[model samples]
Target chain A: MSETRMPALSRRRVIVTAAQLGAASVASAFLARHAAATPESAKEWLGKLAKGEAKAGKVSIKAPEIAENGNNVPVTVAVESPMTAADYVKAVHVVADGNPNPGVASFFLTPACGKAEVQTRIRMATTQNIVAVAEMGDGSLWTATRQVKVTIGGCGG
Target chain B: MAADVKPRIKAPATAKKGETFEIKTLVTHEMESGQRKDADGKTIPRKIINAFHCKLNGREVFSAKIEPAVAANPYLSFFVRAEESGTYEFTWVDDDGSLYKAEHKIAVS
Candidate 1:
């Protein structure tokens, strides 16, 4: 499976590169148009907030490994920051990949927060990955992901 | 509008100067996600508190953009540094244009 997939992936990459070289502006515009679509997936949410990629560090999520009740799972997200006017966390976006809607919540913070941390209860449709992305005042994005097994799905499932 | 919605806040009344403290808040609301169906098989319209804001002495402290995935009776916990003596104002904006407000005073020694 790996051998067959490698060539196919490389071929697609070559095609993409060719297209980019042929019409770099058009390709970028097309990509931007698609990126503007209503984001419903966890990766899309990260892309939207992080502006493309996010590093997996300086942020952490605390939650149970297994949630007996999917209706209300307590989660906390914290980012390492001094909370000073010069350096602080701007916002943190929580996204549950397996939920009906990927976005759980977005917390906006300021230096007065003193700590770049937030706790909230979120609903998950099923067992899935909960991703927390933190946007720093310096425009850097950090992320953390945790998987939770839900015995029963939320949304009355 | 959400029925009997009330905002509850937990914050210290006093703190050492420049000390960090925790603040927990909960507002009662159904947070109907519009994905549920009633007994008659009709969709229950979505009604939720979409936004929450916290301010200290007329300056923004923290805020959140809530979504349907947030459970009913949304609860939030965060931290604030005691810079000075002031009132902390909390506000929740419901989908039906209802504003739920609460306040707590903190003294920085």
Candidate 2:
């Protein structure tokens, strides 16, 4: 009985050690904002800034369905705003659901741009939804989202 | 002085009148979030590029108010409809009172 218990105890120890190692590696990547790193973070950021009601319209986000590389993924966001002095897009926010940092970029625009559009490249940690929130000058909000599957090198080769 | 931060900007060399062109930009920054710790476990003060401004022909083309959530080495691409030939000026302001600037010329044909 004693001999059988020893083997079971050793196996359990090995499993615990391996689990700790994996967590340590991922922890290093997100040294700061450890608590904020989660799928809920993406929406929390939007809620903090936009608050209250947010509708999906006018905001269009363009991103690749399958990204060859997790790093430097190009994203474009466009809003159908007249971009006139009387009415225009005030700001736009980009969020990636699966990255260590969910909020990616925020763009501020003026009427002189002649169009309410922004394009930027971002990093993706894994397969997740990319959301965009557009704020119109009149205090209304619009949003759009797209899913992207990131493939690591060699695996897809 | 330039070693503090460098601004990289890409603008079209030439474009047809009324053509909407894209401008890509990036700045070298660590984007320290203050929540980080040093080797000694000391808290590092948060410093980031809080503002980005772009102007074409003395007109404000695109501008952004960067928040702390933005990733490091902020990269942004925006568009402006070409009305005339002029230079596009970019300015980035850091939280530590550091200012990085760059300019690109665009010829409107």
Worst 10 residues of 2 chain B by lDDT: B65-74
Give one digit per residue, the lDDT tens place, for model 1 in B32-107: 9876779887889999889999999888899999989999999999999999999999999999898999999988
Q: Individual DockQ of the candidates?
A: 0.64, 0.37
Instruction: Please tell me which predicted candidate would have the highest TM-score against the true structure.
Output: 1
TM-score of 2: 0.70
- Of the true interface contacts, each candidate retains a share of 0.88, 0.53
**lDDT at A60 for candidate 2?**
93
Model 2 per-residue lDDT at B13: 95
Find the candidate with the highest DockQ and give its number. Answer: 1
Predicted candidate 1 versus true structure: per-residue lDDT over A41-78, tens digit per residue: 67886677668468899998999999999889999999
Please give each candidate's TM-score. Answer: 0.84, 0.70
